[model samples]
Target: MRRRRTYRLTGGLAAAGLVLLGIPPAAAQEQGGLETQLRFSQRLTQEDGTLSTTTGLGVTLSSRTRTEAFLFSVDSGLEQDFDGSALQQKDPRLILSYSRESLSSALAADFSYRQSDVDALSEDDDISDGVLRLDEGLLKRYSGNLSLQLGRDAPFGGTVDLGYSAKTYSETSDPDLLDEESVNATVALRFDLDPRISAGLRSSFSQTDRDDPGQDTDSASIGGTLDFGVTKTLSTNAYLGYSRVTKSTPGFPEDVQKGLAYTLSFTELRPNGDLSGSLGSDIDEAGRRTTARLDRSLELPSGALRAGVGLSTSEDDDLRPLLSFSYDRGLKRGTFGVKLDQAFSTDSDGEEALNSDFRVTYRQELTPLSSLQAGVVLRDTDFVDDANTDSRKLQLDLVYRHALAEDWNLVGGYSHSISDKSDEDRDHSSKVFIGLEKATRWRF
Candidate 1:
């Protein structure tokens, strides 16, 4: 197991100083607030004919001064399985920010931190080139940004921004899985050219280090952007840049790559919604890649619709297409929604894969204080190079909620899921949960 030294202490201390400086005596005497919630539930799984109990608790604290804001929250849970095994999960988050504006200048700083599960696949995991799987490993991330504007009220005003971010993952059951550490820094300077146009120059550097097998990569890019509004409803942005990347792997040759990068985008803000499109190309350790995307959204009287399409060519010269659509409607006494998505991409190993998902949900108001909701989701994944390694999943859920009081509620839900994999046995699982939830808030 490997770990990186924590770097959040400096930002934390700076935020604390800002809080103290920004809060006046009168503001400090004013009230801050805290909110808390707790729930307990029981679950059943049909695959192994097992029952489990779960409990969750959450709390949030928030405060704001005349020129600063602060928020802290924590969520923790424990699950006890029928087999006598217990799983514990905890997520804690913090946000702190300060902003000040004077006659000629403005300054702002923001910092955030979070610890949670690795919820999705990341590009940095490509070293394994393995099939994507659900990982329950804990992940910690920290980020901060600061911006300063000079001559803010002037037509030729300029703004400078600096940012840093880092992420780490741990607590994996699989010894083969590698822990990751990464840090990123970016700086940008922009000048207002006109009332409807601006220009900016940006530079960024990042490094990612992985343990098992020991790999490290460093990347840097410098770019310029031009933003202009063609009309009140239309606008365009253009960018040109160059990037340099270097990677060192145990078994692979050390390589340094450099290439040009550019992007052009257009956006239309319609009365009802908006439409946008973009095309971009860049080079990195994985080689040169190009991508294009288009998105549109519209609002109806009682509903909303959104759709998007994307296409990209990977370093391996594989072309992948992505499509997605979603629609939601609110009825007099109910709500309905549907979503569909199809995505194609490469796994960590640069192997092409396709993933598709479809979901439908409906909710009906049974009474003024109660509601019934149901949903179904289907997912499919296919590996292009390994057709026999395909997988599919189907899930169904029904939930009922009743308001008991202004701060109390009763919740019950049932869920069932089935998963099928090529050359593997099918797995079926189900759970039923009934719980009373209480929420409380205080100001002091």
Candidate 2:
């Protein structure tokens, strides 16, 4: 099996150093329980780029759990970037939990809080942001043949967990930059509702406090999915969802996000030659940013292979299409695998502005006690979108692992990456890192 080398030895070193220095650890006895981690990385660029480095240390502790049905669970973690300014400071998470179930009825509730601080290179003011989320649901099972669920989901939590907003950070804080909060409700039911058909419904509301003059908005989404079995070897799942929002800025009071996404799958469910495929799309009344995808999977005798093709066209006159394939083979020593990806893109003018990315990876187990992996990656960008965008990129990485004991293990790794942009020379750069990590854990 292939695995990502985890960073644990860095934390141990810090812990050990404190002990040898006759210094008490920051929270040795200050809290609920002790679980911590540390990681360090370096970033560098060319004369056209820049170089940066960072180390990260984090600790999470929370009140003991009640364990009783309907009780809550509380947890929290504090992380600091040694690159100091790279990832900044993060206070991520708090979760509340409750659940109850019987032969015929059940209820559940959950909530969480998360937040973080941003870096300065993003051209905005330094800022603090996060979110709070709460949800509750009730379910019932009827005659061992039917089941139903009714629930409410609220994302009013002011945290930042969205993938799109992740890479974009601010150099400063703007108290006025609105946060996001949303609320939604969903209901679903299942049965041998016939041995062939089941249905569901969902409705949700969300609002954003965006920095773009035309981006701040509020919207509600309503959608559902259907699953049907056509035969013993084939089943299908299709979902259609839509949303409409009231914009926060003038001249645009309403915005709509509607789409149809679907999939068809076939499985031996018994292990011989399982296959599946899916097609989906997201388009609106204006078709400003459109996305489409086609995916397929094959269960080969050697292992399993999956492939996908997708295209995305955005309102800003940007178009991108991507392709990927992966294969997994179980070897006697372990599991071996490989993957590939490529993306082609153009500007609004339909001119080739950027051709980005191609990557391949391989992993193998040398023996019961040792394993290794090697991979290479490359990316190219026109930087037509922004001066900060990269015009070129190259990366390579290698890793090795060996076990010390059932609970103990050691790992070492090396990685290098480079990026260049046509518009900006000062921002071009390269990064290289070599590190080792080890871990040992036990349960009381």
Model 1 worst lDDT run, 10 consecutive residues: 11-20
- Evaluate all candidate structures by whole-model CA lDDT and list the values in order: 0.62, 0.39
TM-score of 1: 0.74
Q: Candidate 1 on 1-444: residue-level lDDT in tens? A: 221111110101101000100112222433434322232323222223555554555555556555444555544445555666656443444556666767778788877776654433221222122333434477677778888878767655566667666656686654434555566667666788888999988888887676747557789999999999999999999999999988777788888989899999999999999999999998755667788999999999999999999997766657878778999999899989888777554333234566776778788899999988777767666666654366676767677778886656676766666667654657565555566555565655
- Per-residue alpha-carbon lDDT of candidate 2 for residues 1-444, written as tens digits (9 for 90 to 100): 111111111111211101110112322323333333322222211111222222323222222222213222222222222334433322222334344444444455544443333210111111122211011111111110112222222211111111112222233233322333333333343333465776655554444444444245455555666778887767887767765644445455554554443333333343544555555543322233455656667787779888877766655546676677777787766555555544434221122233443545566788888777666555444433453234454545555666665433454455444434443532222223332333322212
CA displacement after TM-score superposition, residue 407 of candidate 2 (Å) = 6.8
* Residue pairs with backbone overlap in model 1: 129-348, 129-349
| Candidate 2 TM-score to native | 0.52
- Residue 160 of model 1, lDDT score: 68
lDDT of model 1 at residue 394? 70
